[model samples]
Target: MRDIIEIKRIGGNDVFTIGKIDIEIYKCVAEDIVTDEVIITDERIQHIKSRHPDDYEKYCKYMSEIVKNPEYIIEANKPRTALLLKSFEDEGIPFKTILRLVTSSDNITYKNSIITFMKINDKEWNRLIKNKKILYKSE
Candidate 1:
């Protein structure tokens, strides 16, 4: 069931507003080593749109697909975080999405959600490769 947070009367009509709703914008089983279910929420999309307009315009549609099947999965410096990357031949630049695995306060359920996504230059990609932080690479 979808959670409705607010109801406002607009033009004599009741309008529902959702705050921090758990509606799944995209859900898919990741092909990484862990193979966990990845979820992208509307809140996260707004974050991307506001923070990284250029990336949102260029790579928003590819976010779910990248998480579902990333070309490379690198271990992030933060615990329970991973950087999923996909490179397009035409673009040359790699698109990266930061995935964070968070455990609920009850400690029974988990959420693998994307914190943000952006395009990274070749230098950054090469540094990650050189550091050997990669956990998975597609064949």
Candidate 2:
């Protein structure tokens, strides 16, 4: 079996494939807010605080910067995206086909993460879905 792995976003809709798995991408959009000292209320921040309290302050500070200005995150995520694309190319998979399918789909509002789904050809699908009986005889 051949599998394709990569991430893509079309019309703000995010999609990705990993091996034979397919999924939809959902991004957590940070809301712009104003406060006296910038509260780090994101779940990620809390989680980091619990596990890495030593770095929690710095992590929260960084998260605040990301929330206040998202361009940094966008730039940071680009290189990771590029590496993922390279991985797919190395795997001999057609990443463009998946993007085309998502673009042609009716869904939008997904972005910035990788979701993967198993997409089998019609012949394979039929073979898998068809009812069959295995006969075994022991002598």
Candidate 3:
């Protein structure tokens, strides 16, 4: 018996069809490896735009704010803390969380609009956490 087959190629991959049976075959063979990746399409974009316009606008506004304030890209120091506080204020994230991440020692001081504190290196910070000198704020 001879069977008719329909083959379709989509997203740089080949799909084979024999009657109702569909199979995906690749040239390269590997064991226990993931091959297929999901691709987002224009239809999905239009659907999201139509359904969640407010969310899309909020994301754009947040990105714009970040672009406007380039100093937020710095490390976890006083200046960075101030920028993060501003970001938290805009995003409704708690200020205490931001403070906890930047505060290394109990010698944190505020002067005018800036906060100053001892900056701990990553190694020391890891050691402190390991010794339980300072509890991790995240639990």
Best by lDDT: 1
Mind sharing the TM-score for model 1?
A: 0.62
| Whole-model Cα lDDT of every candidate shown, in order | 0.61, 0.24, 0.26
Q: Could you give me the TM-score of model 3 versus the true structure?
A: 0.20
Backbone clashes in model 1: 0
Clashing residue pairs in candidate 3 (N, C-alpha, C atoms within 3 angstroms)? none
Tens digit of lDDT per residue, candidate 2, span 1-139? 1122344554464333322212211022122211112121233334544654544442222322222222111111222121011112233321101111122122443222221112224454334324322111112
- Per-residue lDDT tens digits for candidate 1, residues 1-139, read 1333345554464433322212222122222322244555566667878887877766665665676667877877776667777887776768878886543321343346678888889988788788856777778
Clash count of each predicted structure: 0, 11, 0
TM-score of 2: 0.20
* Backbone steric clashes in candidate 2, count: 11
Question: Which one wins by TM-score: 1 or 3?
Answer: 1
TM-score against native, each model: 0.62, 0.20, 0.20
